[model samples]
Target: MRRVLGLLVVVFVAIVCAGRDLYEVLGISRDASSPEIKKAFRKLSLKLHPDKNPGDDEAAKKFAEVASAYEVLSDTEKRKKYDMYGEDGLKEGGGGGHDPFDIFSQFFGGGRQQRQQEPSRGNDVVVPLRVSLADLYNGKNIPVSMRRKVVCQHCHGKGAAHADDIQTCHECGGHGVKIETRRVGPGFIQQFQTTCNKCGGKGKIITSTCPVCGGHKTNFGDVEFDVDVEKGMQDGQEVEFEHYADEFADRSAGHVRFRITTTPHELFSRDGDDLWMDMNISLKEALVGFKKNFVHMDGRIVEVNRNEITEPSQVITLKDEGMPKYQYASEKGKNYFTSRLLILCIGQLNIKINVQFPDTLSAEQKQGFRELFAM
Candidate 1:
């Protein structure tokens, strides 16, 4: 009876060991394809890699298990046998085993195919660009800095350490979509289609995750670009950089938009294409005459002189002294100066009649003097 008990115990142990699912070791379902199995293995391997988690025996064991799972699933013939006959099929060497990377090359086409495939575009970015009045007057090139995501250099945007790490999706069976039926009411049902849950609608999976990017496959870094400000551009204008956005998955490169803002100037006030300024003159200068020199916008000295007596509130117009015409074939503008005159009385004197000079003036002259003084 004891001998019989020992045999039964052996049988039970075998059954328990054989029943352990290999899919769990690779963190995947039994229906996972060759590519999906590889992708999952690579992702787990990187996290539990001996090089990354040194001195951790558990992690090392996990990494080994992941590698082993990839080795079996990546080979088509071996994978087929494993799917049909379990692990025992490979013990007799009938399975035509191949390297995991070779299987990836065959399934994905080739190296050239991977490179020629279109990558997802990035997002468009925008920023406010401030410019000086002078810059606005004569366009300029402005440099800008920004941060954005770029494809990972280590994995080349594959999101895996190697090609062998990719796997076909089990949930959708590589179709990338799933159909479902839901009961709307008694004896009635509605059908709808949705992306596969297992593959997240991609119809594929990463067996081995990229060690450098950890499956993110992108890095954040600084980007510098130059935007051209066109001449004669008005305030609040925008300059666009075509296809210069931050690179990412799911879309093509977008544009970088720059909004232009003109800074205020102390010396000049802009009115359309004309510039205005204030000039002051003394009252004496206004009554008599005055000549003055002022600086133009281009730093040239211009002299303005007035010889005629300028009356109070009289305006002096300077032709062509305004701002340059904007895209107009005209160079005419009026600069007006309003004069304010202040008259001053120095003194007043009262003198005796000069016509009777020396007390010997003629009677006619005296009469004339009396008459002039009477009024």
Candidate 2:
């Protein structure tokens, strides 16, 4: 009975020591593909890099553990050994003499030593900006307003109420990584690796949460900006705001992009760089000739006059009346006016005349008189 109890206690200790779930370690479901496992590892590496979080021993340990798990699972031979013998198989050189980190480094191109840090640029954000057609034609600077995420002023972007609240991570032993294993099929086990949970893979912990942001690194608000639209600028053209994106804790930011949108105009339709306006004329005016004038968008007067007969569907060209040329040249454009004509005809009229024909009028004259009188 004493020997049996000791055996049971040893088994319990073994189970307790091997507590991590491989599936959960890699943050993937049981059915995750090999490629998916690799992608998850890369993402976690970037997040929990030792350089990103300094002096975090737990994060470093977690990182190494995640790397080890990936090394075994990513290989067919080692995977088989791990499947049969578990961690013992890997430890006893059943994996054919392979260094897990070496394999991981080869697959992910190896880790880099900390180098000179550079100021990070912000991200770029895009918003649709609407403008009138007239504004596009004449060119204008549109003032735009939007709300964006900015750094918190109270905590100086540390996201904590005070510095003392921050603490080192305990789970990964400051390595910021963890390892896990799963049974794939009969006699086959797959291993997965992931960031350490206790430290959120950061290999560090915040003993005291920030009172302002509650340990969340970010906050939100409004930002106003201007978009300069050039004359004859086409719709959907992008207006850029350099380095105006969301603020980061490390003071890195991105840019803001604005897409220009034009509102539909009642009087005109735009085609490329040209502007089109339709004018209607009566048939009488088209035939007898007439003068027509209309107001332009810029409050300029445009007139069309013709003394000679104008045919229907006749187009008259007006120089320098179209939209201003964009980018290529500053030359003015031309305007085309169309004309329609209608003609009217009256019936012949009859007249009464009393005339005395010569006394010697011929028989032809008498016939003519009889015909005329009958009509």
Candidate 3:
């Protein structure tokens, strides 16, 4: 009663003063609206959310600051008062505010607790996918079929031909788990849940089973998926297919992750999304000139014309000819992955020169070579 009355009195008597520094903490203007404030809060929360930065006191403290700022800016009256009288006003209002941890939970994983028995996600299936440098350069999708555990199509995961034959287990009372209390010591006890012995952890049992899948809800079957090989994707990078690996009755399917491995390409050698190759040039061609169209990984013709004297280790760099940038860039923070494409960075292929000489020179060619050396 005193907390509420005291707050009302303080709010009524609150006059003008300076401002609280919450805006600075959130990196927003003093006049920021609710959406701008929320955006700032979300950005900080994603960075400092406890799950992402577990056991770190510094991140926890930073997250608290973000939550505090959101608390003040979120409420219009509190914001007005804070803007007018700063921290002193909050003190005068008797300090009724949110718990930072509570706000953080609500922002991240709080609502999940209110949901009905959540389905368990199956284990992630990791496989190595071999690819060529050309696939990475051109960006192609390779179709692959993997035999995985998936829900039975005939039973639709019910494990029974007739839905009416499925009945709830009387032992666990439709709950798959069985809880039992254990005596620890004098006046001490422990409780735990285990798989119900009657239904075998399945809340329901089928009297008449499906002919195709037998009684089990899941069966190993060939699941086909396409791997979209992106340009510039690093070797051993994971390409994930959500909920496509393993399946269980009433449980969410686990993800299928492909760790990309590159096979030795015949033409180009890759290095962290960049490519390099050697172009052999004959003595006559290096000295005089040459013009030809080189086929790129995507089958596009790259025109190359060399007219000047070529050095043994001279390199020809073609901008945007390396590997395509991976898709990860397009997703993270709004406009965080901007590439000054014109700047000679990744995606530029370097073709080096390896000059060749004949084993033996003809008399006329030797005389001409001698003349050229003399000049």
Candidate 4:
């Protein structure tokens, strides 16, 4: 009996050593990255899937091997064990018992039928964000803080203390719904289906609920995100954070959008990419000539001078002094285009002159003004 046991151990070691390399199975190198491994697995799985090649035992076996290889390599700890100790190391680390079909289904969005049964997205959340004109003019990253529903950290959204604590509901048989018959009239019956009361339409029962969320599988947590206000962004433009809304168990999180709303500025108003401001000037400055300076939105001092007479309500155009033109995704990051094309797209600043007149003129001042205007 001892000899036979020794021989069995030797045989097992030989089989494990002779087994094909997992990397070679997926057609990737030993140094392949996670994304590379995933890409290779996706390609091979698509071609060797049982649905694609039915009744081919060879393809089916290869598909299973590929799934197993990906399952190990995708996990950081499992992959480290496998790399050091091979199959025996994996066994020692409690690895390599996952269902291959489950991994495959999850990677490919649960096949076609399971995808249809998956829960829809939750409700989207939109919040209004107020920004100053200076922030929009110079581009800013504003940090926003809000409370949102996130998956419970304790149970990982399982709603149970342990995996074994969850079991299929007996009343609905895991269908999440039950059929009932009601008497409508004499010798007549109406049948209808309704959510299972035992499972609360979840099709599963938790023996012990999660302590953090109390079986709700989610909790409201404070989250902070940055809202990028690009230069020349229009009012009411939405900045979307995908999958950042309230999360619920078994459902995808909806998107969160922050709609940009510019606060009223005391000096400047914007239209498209252009900026307009009223410049108050004394009557002498408008009639004779003057040089004055005004502060721009970005704290730059803009100088305006008129050697000739300036009139009230006259608009002066300052080229390339307003907001910077927004660089779209398609046109961004090109050095030559930014230097040549975008440089010419800056918005103009229109300065509307408003002349202040004196309430009354003395007789000597009126005579001097009349004599000066007579010239």
List TM-score per model, in order: 0.47, 0.49, 0.54, 0.63
Estimate, for each residue in 50-119, the C-alpha lDDT of model 3 and write its tens digit: 4556467566566666777777777788888888877666677664445564564454333334435536
Residue 361 lDDT (model 4): 91
Candidate 3: residue pairs that collide: 322-347
State candidate 2's TM-score.
Answer: 0.49
- For residues 1-375, could you state the per-residue lDDT of candidate 2 as single tens digits? 323432443343334325454456567665555545665675565455444445665554455555556666656676677567666766664333233234434543312222234466665688888888888777777777777777776666766677776666767777798778899999998888889978888777777656666666667767666566766677877665645678777766766778878999886667775566665665546556778776766777877776776565555555556666453111122111111100111112111112222456589977976997697
Model 3 poorest ten-residue lDDT run? 330-339
Candidate 2 accuracy as lDDT: 0.59
The residue-level lDDT of candidate 2 at 36 comes to: 56
The alpha-carbon lDDT assigned to residue 147 of candidate 1 equals: 85
Candidate 3 versus the native: TM-score? 0.54
Using TM-score, rank the candidates from best to worst.
4, 3, 2, 1
TM-score (C-alpha) between model 1 and the true structure: 0.47
Runs in model 4 lying further than 4 Å from the true structure: 1-119, 179-195, 329-344
Clashes of each: 18, 31, 1, 0
What's the residue-level lDDT of 286 in candidate 4?
87
Q: Name the lDDT of candidate 3.
A: 0.71
Model 2 lDDT at residue 17:
25
Candidate with better lDDT, 1 vs 4: 4
Regions of candidate 1 where Cα sits further than 4 Å from its true position: 1-123, 181-191, 302-375
Winner by lDDT between candidate 2 and candidate 1: 2
Point out the worst 10-residue segment of candidate 2 by lDDT. Answer: 335-344
